[model samples]
Target: MDGARLDQFDRKILSLLQADGRLTNNDLSERVNLSPSQCSRRRQRLEDDGFIKGYRAVLDRDRLGFPLVNVISVTLATHNRDNAQRFADLVAKLPEVQEAHALTGEMDYILKVVTPDLKSLADFVNGVLLPHEAVQHVKTAIVLQTLKETSALPL
Candidate 1:
């Protein structure tokens, strides 16, 4: 549904869901001041309309043995559709790459990579990224600390 179509109830539902995706229909209904069935139907509509993509549990990287996080800037050899698509496809297959974004700047793409250690990050950059035909240059910066990190959007 369009943004104009979303009422206060819809907005509240979205806000609550963003904070806690595991909230039950009854709880969400009470928060939004709607009946459970109404809440469920609205939630279903939100999902079908692509506003809510899917639910997933947020995991702690340090606890999961992936403490090292690196932001990598990549420059492609050629700025062509084929090269860009190839690079994107390769990155999608890499489990270490948590996030990748193509940009309109000097660097072709920026990647957020998480690994168990510095050696693993170095190996990924040297072995996989540098060896790619499309990759021209790669610059990496390790994260010292994270002040804040969240996937929630301001509705």
Candidate 2:
């Protein structure tokens, strides 16, 4: 469905779900002032229409033994389609790479990587990234503290 077609109920459902994906239909309905059946149908429709991609449990990286987080700027050797595709494919297979983005600035791509420790981060960058034929330059910045990090979107 088009975004413009989303009603207030739909927006509330999305907001509630984003805050807590594990909320049951009964609970969600109560919170949104809708019947359980209505809530369920609306949720299913939202999912079917691709508003809700999927659900996942958000994990604490530090508790999960991945305390180190680094943001890396990557510059490619060439700007050709083949090299970009190859880099994307390689990044997709890497478990340490939590996020990657193609940028508009000097760097070709930026990557958010997480690892258990400094040694592991070093190993990933030196062993995996530098050895790749597509990679020309890489600069990394370690995250000391996160003031605010969230996935919630304002409705």
Candidate 3:
């Protein structure tokens, strides 16, 4: 995809924004060594070019009763297009399946999931995932601790 190439100023802007998305234009400008108007214009251009897609508040999953986090690897019966799409649609409707990706090798898909506890996770597997017609097998690995979890993209 052809897009605007990032220069040093753009990289600085991204670095500052990645840390604190809610920074005021004035604050951001000061941090990035640009005038308020210039910073505002640059940020808007970044958004228009799809460099800065959107901003969101990161919430603690534990506070929402979804402390448990795990990665689920799914293997499908076949590599056909229909089966892959069916699997994707099925995973989309399941709230517990936070993110899904069609992958390579033995595992056809990988999912990032969050739930209340191990029992709840088991229930989801038995009640929902296993029942899906396209899913051949599913393997899950629980996350005991997170070493690093940041959405910042290196410029």
Q: Write the per-residue lDDT of candidate 3 for residues 1-155, one digit (tens) a residue.
A: 23456777888888889888998889988887889999999899988988888998988899989999999998887778998888888887888887888777888889999999999999988788888888889899999998998788776
Reference-based lDDT, each prediction: 0.95, 0.95, 0.86
Give lDDT: candidate 2, residue 58.
93
- Say what the RMSD of model 1 is: 0.8
Candidate 3 segments exceeding 4 Å error: 1-4
Q: What digit string (tens of lDDT, one per residue) describes model 1 on residues 68-139?
A: 999999999998999999999999999999999998878989999998999999899999999999999999
Q: Comparing 2 and 3 by TM-score, which wins?
A: 2
Report how far residue 64 has shifted in candidate 1, in Å.
0.7
lDDT of 1: 0.95
**Could you give me the TM-score of model 2 versus the true structure?**
0.97
Candidate 3 total steric clashes: 0
lDDT of 2 by residue, 1-155 (tens): 79899999999999999999999999999999999999999999999999999999999899999999899999999999999999999999999999999999899999999999999989999999999999999999999998988878778
Better of 1 and 3 by lDDT: 1
Q: What 10-residue stretch in candidate 1 is worst by lDDT?
A: 146-155
**How many angstroms is residue 27 displaced in model 3 relative to the true structure, after the best TM-score fit?**
0.7
Which pairs of residues collide in model 2? none
RMSD of 3: 1.6
